[model samples]
Target: MTQIVQSLAEISKPYDALFCDLWGCLHNGVAPFPEAVAALQAFRASGGKVVLLTNAPRPAKFVIESLERMGCPKDAYDLVVSSGDAAQDAMFAGAVGRKVWHLGPSKDDGFFTEIPAEWQGQADIERVDFDDAEGIVCTGPFDEINEVPEDYRAKFLLAKMRDLPMLCANPDVVVDMGDKRIYCAGALAVLYEDMGGEAMYFGKPHPPIYDMARRKLAAIGGVEDGRILAIGDGINTDVPGAAGEGIDCLFVTGGLAHDQFGADQKNPDPELVRAWLGARQTDPRYTIGTLR
Candidate 1:
């Protein structure tokens, strides 16, 4: 457990490569954190490789587009590996000939864009209604999960009993999308699992995302597990995921955990920070604070 003064320059020195989390550490979903972005730019200028690893359900290209709109230059990081990309890859590898019924917004249909042309129509969930589907590839139903009617439970059970595997594109159960707690695919996957369905996750806190990040890091001459640095704000996903890979982690205090600890309240005391840090006792190497 190494606790430094929480300066990005100082903390970034020991590692030659950085696998950074996009949402909370680099930017809140809506806006870019100039200071954090500047730190990444500085790291890149100094010859360090930076890769943005996000749990966003969209593919890496889509995430890059979103970041660009938020003023995040493509050069800020060498490459990106999103949960959506991982999920799509898993789906293609596992279900080459099987039918997939995705339950998400129409915009998310792009996830199956890489499927073979012959399977494209069958791969598309929007074209065929849910009742005619063979399997489920859930990205997220957004607010629809809250109002899932009781009658739907039987249908979900039947799908599970048929051994229809579900791929959860986004493993984040919930995210602070602006000022609201929006549900993600992980929540729906959990529900399906509770109903005895087989579910595969492809995002943060899962090895596939980390494995993808590690491969990207290696492509750009990054260090091995012992020397890589993982920076993020979500403890449940980021901290645990990094620790599982035997990498060091830096936790940002201005993200979800901070809000959960009431650090956003008026006159938040240091005790809250202390308690939060104490709760994360299992994380091997960590520091807590804003990116200064």
Candidate 2:
């Protein structure tokens, strides 16, 4: 684990591009971190490309809209690649001509609006036969999955036994929803996989989203992969995902873990950060009090 001073001015050697995580590193889902926003703007003014890589379940447009609402200026980022966008890509890549059973909130339907006209809506899999259907797409409600009854689980398992592949739109197991740790698509996917189902993920900690972000960065004349930097707060998603892609990561404290472990108890302890990363075997390139 490395400890770097939290001074944006010290970043003299401007990176070619920056891949920043959305939730905890940039904002706490409610407001944009003023420092983070300023830093991004500074980096861009210095000719650095900024690409925001988010694990948000919504598509790029929705994510951008949300950022705008949260006070992050449009100029703060060059491109936004969301898990929701990756999910849409995965849906079309494998199941173009077939029908899909979408299991998610109503708002998530917008994600599939771009899909082929023939590949939409839910249907009985057993009656239609396995070869005819495309696959199961899930963009689960952060609040609903945990409350599901055992019967729903049994039914979903039966669907899996029929050899239907499941494409998980959001790979986050859970996210902070107004002080609650709600279930996410990845958690349900894990359960499905445990029941002998084949699940494909399309979000953070997964490679496709990172690949897309990299491509977008390259298009904007951003730095090559070696000079790119990833800033995130979640160890399970952002940190590991960036590290897996061989990009440098700057971990922000005071997100989910800070709340779970009591923020006031330990705010600026390098040893504590090291222990947290060490437990997960994810040593980030830098650790900071906050991304801002």
Candidate 2 C-alpha error for residue 131, in Å: 14
Instruction: Write one digit per residue (lDDT tens) for candidate 2, span 85-200.
Output: 87777666554224777767776766766443344554322212334555677788423635542334775777676777888888887666545566677777888888888888
**Model 2: CA > 4 A from native:** 12-14, 95-97, 115-134, 142-152, 260-266
Q: lDDT tens digits, residues 1-292, model 1?
A: 4453456797677888888888767876778877788888899899888888888888888888889888887778898889987777777665522467777776686786645343455433333455666668888873443634233477678787778777889887776766656677777788888888888887888899988787767776757777678888777888788888888887776777656546443223456656666776644365556654
lDDT per model, in order?
Answer: 0.73, 0.72
TM, every model:
0.85, 0.85
Ten contiguous residues minimizing lDDT sum, candidate 2: 122-131
Clashing pairs in 2: 16-223
**Model 1 vs. true fold: TM:** 0.85
lDDT of 1 at 153: 70
Q: For model 1, what is the alpha-carbon lDDT of residue 215? A: 72
Model 1 ranges off by over 4 Å:
1-4, 95-97, 114-128, 142-155, 261-270
Report the number of the highest-lDDT candidate: 1
